[model samples]
Target: MSTMGRAGQAPMVVVDGVRKAFHGVTVLDGISFEVAAGDVVAFIGSSGSGKTTLLRCIDLLEPIDAGRIVVAGEAMGWHQQPDGRWVRDSERELARKRQHLSMVAQGFHLFSHMTALENVMEGPLTVKRLPLPRARQLAQELLAKVGLADKAHARPSKLSGGQQQRVAIARALAMGPEVMLFDEPTSALDPELAGEVLATMRQLAAEGHTMLVVTHELAFAREVADVVLMFHEGRIVEQGPPQEIFTRPAHEATRRFLARVTGGVPQPTGSS
Candidate 1:
């Protein structure tokens, strides 16, 4: 493994020849992709197709057995030393490189004891070591951005599922991340509540945030994604602009998966 900043013209996030496995089962095989700044890319596939695993690898949440992950042009991995011993980079180095990325998971992972305001402020005040006053100010602004300003003082338990997920989004924003990753961010919510979370995400997309999301929401992917990746088994079988991938998929596996989940041709209608 090696670590270095991306050269000029490099993508914000790049995965090259990445492969991962658990026990003897492979989850991702020779996966590769690049996401430029402000791009909205969505990963769609059937369950167990490794969509979530790919997202996790990008964030270093799950270490890959082989491959290179570069974020904001910084490549991350263990480095070989001159003494014939492999030396891993310090955690502090990795932390510094990851400062500009944030992730929102399917399950809203909020601190139960903290109010919505505090939850959003924690990342800045703690990890970033920002001043309390400054953190609070930013937190409030982010909560407002997510349409949760009125629920700032409410604890996670007091908020609805949709409200909680919104707070999670706010918390991720507090880090001022350049790239945001969402792994099925709305999968846990009911239809009505899921709309609220998706609305917040749509707003982010409109504001030109670079985002990569793994989701089963085909309509949402079609509406918000600039590029759509169809993962089958353990690799990306097909990828292209949403219109092409959704309507003129080039792979049999992709067409079959889409047909099973979407029930025939996908209409050009936007997701509600």
Candidate 2:
């Protein structure tokens, strides 16, 4: 795949021909996509479609077996040194590049022992290396941002699933990422609780935060995504603005998948 950087555009995140596998099975097959500054893109697909794998590849949690990933304008790939050490090309460069990105996963992954406030502060204190007092203050502010100020002292076990997920989001924001990747952030919550998390996401969208979300929440995607991508069998079968793809999908696989997901027949085009 060819790589080019456009002038007069802020570098966000790029995945080019990224391929990943586990054991003998290929999960992501030469996937390529770009997320622009302040754009909210949603990935929608049935199970085993590699949506989650693509998310992991972007975050470097799962290394791609082939292809390149560039985030915030820095390229990344492996290099072998003369001493036989397999080194990551531009490790320092990647570190600096990653400061612009943050990720939230399906599981809340909160610290069991720490209060919600401490969980939010941990990233700033460890990653940003801010002083303890400053981190605590910033954590409180972020918790309030997520509407969890009153629950600051609550532990993960004490908070509802939605509240815990909000704290997880607050933790991600503490790292000061320019773009956030959410992997099914509301999947584990009940419907009402999930609405709470979605509301927080909507607020972030209104603030113009660049975000890419992997989710099965079709309603949320229809409501908030600027662009929606439909994945099937390790490839993107369809993508477009939410209205076009959801209301007038051009691909049969997309229509079938949507039918299964929404539990209704795909609506005929131009139907009222």
Candidate 3:
């Protein structure tokens, strides 16, 4: 319900006191944040610290045990009834709500049997019921947007890791999501391959896509994020502008994390 944003517009995504658990182990604890339209918010933390889980909760790929996630003003996972009771939404309803957001995972989960263009066209054609010509056109445009126009006829196995990831990005974009969720999108790629995927993500940020990215790419976080959140033990311990979080982290956990990842606390990119 907190719509306050730097630009005075309602936020695109709101996660309020969200908590999630898996097999009796808490994964997300009291997580809350607001992603303003066009904001690129990066989440960083050690493995098992719950960064990816938070993205899953936001995408409704994993149900939160408590709290609410709202995207584009509609509650996800559950809806309130007239009698004041909260009820879980049906699978059909959840599918409809999922259209408001799209997620790209670490692994490029492309369909091996489909070409990049066919894979990108799958969502709009099947889920949105777009006409064949319209879906094809949209997929073509998105593939081009992600710099994969030439790879349209290539299958997943035929593409490089970076190219496959770019195709995955194009497929996500074909859905016309209001918010984009990235869960360690480049972690599975080699440095060279990761760079290409990162470049595509950077382009998305520049194009004003509201994004929530969970990543270990510290430089990307510092360079591209409007806000950087440091998660520890399933909680966000530090969050601020990238300069503050990267250069002047106030939390001990944050400092330790930076030291472990980058040898020591790194200064801002252009600092003397």
Candidate 1 at 6: error in angstroms?
A: 15
lDDT for model 2:
0.85
Predicted candidate 1 versus true structure: per-residue lDDT over 73-149, tens digit per residue? 67665555798775555788667766768999999999999999999999999999999999999999999999989
TM-scores of all candidate predictions against the true structure: 0.91, 0.89, 0.95
Better of 2 and 3 by lDDT: 3
**Candidate models: Cα lDDT each:** 0.86, 0.85, 0.90
lDDT of 2 at 184: 98
If both were scored by lDDT, which would come out higher, candidate 1 or candidate 3? 3
> Candidate 3 vs. truth: CA RMSD?
1.8
Clashes of each: 2, 0, 0
Candidates 2 and 3 compared: the better one by TM-score is 3
- lDDT by residue (102-162, candidate 2, tens digit) is 8888999999999999999988888789999999999999999999999999999999999
Instruction: Give the lowest summed-lDDT range of ten residues in model 2.
Output: 1-10
Model 3 residue-pair collision total: 0
CA shift of 96, model 3, Å: 0.6
